[model samples]
Target: MSEEFPIQPKFGPFLRLFLHSQLFCTPQLPTQSFADQTVIITGANVGLGLEAARHFYRLNCARLIIAVRTVSKGQTAKEDILQTVKHRNEADAIEVWDLDLTSTASTVAFAERVNKELPRVDVLVQNAGINSKTYAVSEGIEQTMQVNVSNTFLLALLLLPKLTETAKSAKSLPHLTIVTSEAHHLAKFPQINTPDIFESLNDEKFYNGQSSYEISKLMQILFVREFVSRINAKNPPSPSVIVNLVNPGLCFSTLATRNEKPLAARIIGSIIYKIIGRTTEVGSRTLVLGASAGPTSHGEYMSDGQNQDVESWIYTDVGIRAQKKVFEQTMKVLESRKPGLGYAVGL
Candidate 1:
């Protein structure tokens, strides 16, 4: 009876504050519906990428291609998405294909398959990434660098024609959306200086226990800028393609558990993480935004929920100044590998 006499709504003040803050906030939301657009989100078996696929489908996405390293996992994820949209108005159009972003042969093969099967890829989300304590190798390159940067770069390059085709065919030109990370700032600029990255992939003894993950992420942003420049140089003005990068804020997921830290260390880290770590759903927001939105700016680095000009953050503009060198080095690494089964540049 006393409470009823003085009932006050909790969060009333906070709600008022939020409403006031909205006046100063920037507008959000895509200009158009995602229907009829085909999006390929890598590493969609789980984590942020998986969440993106689910949300996109919920919004009645025309097609969702979930690229996974594991075939069984991919199949399972496909089934789950189908179940969710089972009662929806449109029939399910979700697909899952195998893609290992560590091997050149694998990346090329996946690209070739996509070109053959997918007439248009409206959005390409480079969401798959890896980090490690010791320098690991894949296809004669550091695992972190290769998977996060080199392999991703090769895939993007290989699919350029298809992406262009998709854009040309689409009502609205398509976009290339890449998922980089805030950890990029921690890297010592993008440099292929560490030849050990190539030598250490096969020789664990030669591998230094170092974090190449940050460097790889740095290279990712650099690669995006380079790719955009190359496309512009080769294409006419007012090209249909748009390229953008996004950094999903820190999230609690398998990426944290990947390192084999002590039990107490893990517990303490998790507790601290719980205090600040964002949910997977929140982390996927920027990716969805970048993928669906047309070119707000070319080669923009969307991080911390803000799109920062990556060109401003560079410590050394050497790579930017020497586009040809960077491109040649990347192509050299990719072409060095023997063309394995089902691997080809063009259909």
Candidate 2:
């Protein structure tokens, strides 16, 4: 199975991408019952993740696990979500679990715990992410790349077994929703040509004036494409899980207002957000839609609750080659962290 999407006309596509900023109806789901599914949403303490979790609860998801770096904050968000959501049963459950994305040990531990305890992982939403303004390293990799690119996909790979297990036993297509963003369109990814993209990104000079976060997001897009291909190539009678990347459009994000950036840029961003940015609740519906989106949406990029094409260049041979490199290197790093992960995950 080739991972390449048909390239669209570069000039024609943007005019159609209304983004969440200009206008979009609140995504409404028909009354659906997730009365027996276990849904896990990371970064559920605040922002889009929190809102997405609330929507799943509203849909009557039987067991919800709100994974957060801070348990206290997760508890607060859990309470807020539980307040008005109608329940399926008094025995229905929502629990706050600890998951620190910044640490490899923590991420592995979280997934291990999930595999051990969770009866099923009906949907795994990879919502937790970071936008680091200054240069920093975690686990010897640049901090932003460490969490967003390396660890994020690591957790995804580690959890694949349980997800596939849920699929087989439940006879349901489990969802693995990885959060991406429109900011990837801004990523030139100048370091992609380097002998080692991840290593080049570690140089403080490369990140000094460059958009490290945006580049990381581009890596995410590439990673998903290649990952879907490898899994589908396994030649199962049918896919056990649906995996896709989602762009929530430009949400009114505090990360947009980081202090290290230019003053004029921040001012302009604040103005734009006021004029057009989406609220976390409105933005989060994409996550909900992505998780529920069926077979056709597998490996697609979802925007505004529908399958949307990515940047036109991504379908080109150059882009296809880059996609392979990113996923290969990402898998290399992840495997170094946890030997044999790629084969073990059926990738």
Candidate 3:
């Protein structure tokens, strides 16, 4: 039987719960024996994305594409996975592709490649995202917003056709899993505004550190809920595909720390993390759960491998309402942009 926690966690330190809980038995989860399914995992070079890829590979999923920004690093990750999984052949299983979600051009190129070559993509995990030390701009938008929100939005839109096609052909189902964060619980709401814009590259105000990180995470959840609603409205009962969001419980893996402070500062942080963070294996469990076939709540947020039936009073309604508005705005932005791009910028 699947495990259940009697004590639901609070939003601020949900990662703490994620790090500390053994929410489910990995061995008992569904296997890839289901008809060959193709899954695309972003940010697969390391951290949660890499771990998630390994999970899919073990299930013997048809084709697991590692869509990463660093193509070379991605290749190395592919090698590592092959080595880690016993008796696994390199071909007919895992592949790598270049995808820098921060750039509209790159997002487009990646989508085009997938649309042209792959027959059907069963899962598109929007796992690639970033946070910078100082403020920066990507594709003319705030760096965090661009990578975490806009680019993600664009990629989801571009991949919709393939997702739709796969949903129709397979007769089973397709899913879009987004790697969101518990930090979203802190966001005042999901409405995108001028203040929400990253002021400038290296803007210290934005980088006081924790605040910016939390804000980006908040946007991520909003994006997930927003996308789900749109998919339902546009596609209807055929539903074809479903979108779900997850906050991989805080394991001590680098989300944006790869670009963080001085070596000493990073080391100190790592030490602190060692004291609190979960292993990569533990942190990625919920993400893997989100991607798998299950009863995923449409237009809802999930944490610790299960849906949060009752949210904190402060966040309960705002999170939902804000996500709805943000979804509408995101569609308008995507609808207005030129076709053939993975992400559209300029607000």
Candidate 4:
């Protein structure tokens, strides 16, 4: 690696990206089998998460867990998969579990359930996140930051033991993949200069709906880098848990255009989606790729089908400063949710 970051993204503009999408293609669907792997995917009721779960089940993953906010929606997603894909073992092959990222209590309970019921977890796809234009709060925090960044990592860390244990017992490199976006590079991160990123983010007076999602995505990437550094902090790592962040690119997803957006915004978004977005099915392939990635991908960013260097800005002086600040502040907030979680997760 050179002093400069590798492969700084060249097509950062919308027009260039749209033209690129027009010329290139989504990730070629993975035909690799996931046999014997117990895979868990968040927000699997629809969109990328649901389609990703479908691929795993189609590839003959032994056990599939569709973690969702509502069990009913998950059931619907499961039934859709069963009807479309031919399954050999019919009953209990797929389990639906409740996971509400908006609430710390819910996040904690969900992890506890996984620890209690699941024999092992080979892959965890953190595909559930929000991109809304509305200002809302959950559990006394801004909803977007809570779901997309805070609780998301909390769930991952809470389940670290399960992932590492499965790695050792199954002789596999378990994966913990977080679904992020290319828009992270566009984040102004209005809170970066503040003494506390999370605290500043909580100041509703300064909250921006548009940049909030981008900031959260950026935070996810930053946090993953910091988290991996700690995961193997002491020297020899515990059982290998390949942690990765993936960008599915802009895709046609109903989740993002739901009531959380105004009609005008939704209409404009729909037009943009039709012009340049890949289908949810196509986008999900990237998630599957990220989840199946090997040890070399640890602490790396995966896009389309392979590891890509993050934007050069992320390696710049400004970006490095922002990264360190966000990680330190994030840990302080997360520690309250799970005391000594850094140590618990082998930090």
Q: Which prediction has the highest lDDT against the true structure?
A: 4
| TM-score attained by model 4 | 0.92
Query: lDDT by residue for model 1 over 271-299, one digit each (tens)?
Result: 86686676777677777877766466567
Clashing pairs for model 3 are 108-342, 135-201, 135-202, 184-218
Error of 1 at 129 (Å): 1.3
Give the alpha carbon lDDT tens digit for every residue of 1-347 in model 4: 34221223344563465357444957989888888999999999999999999999998889999999999999999999888887554647899999999999999999999999899999999999988777888876789999999999999999988998998777568999999987776676656766667777878787787688888998999888877776566657543788999989888886566646667877898887887788899999999998888777899888886887676667777566666777888888789889998788777
Per-candidate Cα lDDT values, in order, are 0.68, 0.82, 0.68, 0.83
Evaluate model 1: give its lDDT: 0.68
TM-score of 1: 0.80
Q: Residue 117, candidate 3: how far off, in angstroms?
A: 0.5
Q: Please, what are the lDDT tens digits per residue for candidate 3 over residues 1-347?
A: 42221212265565444444434422234343433889898999898889888888877778999999888999998988888888567565888999997788898799889989999998888888775666666656667777877778788778877886897777467878878876655554322333333333235454544556666776566666655555565554545666777777556777746674888988887886776666776767677777764645555566666775323532555445655555655555555554533233211
* Worst-scoring 10-residue span by lDDT in model 4: 1-10
Q: What's the ranking of the predictions by TM-score, best on top?
A: 4, 2, 3, 1
Give the Å shift of residue 325 in candidate 3: 3.7
Q: Please give the distance, in angstroms, between residue 56's alpha carbon in candidate 1 and its true position after superposition.
A: 1.6
What are the runs in model 2 whose C-alpha is more than 4 Å off? 1-21, 24-26, 29-31, 86-92, 208-210, 257-266
Candidate 4, residue 115: CA error in Å? 1.0
> What TM-score would every model get versus the actual structure?
0.80, 0.90, 0.81, 0.92
Better of 3 and 4 by TM-score: 4
Model 4 misses residue 85 by how many Å?
0.5
Better of 3 and 4 by lDDT: 4
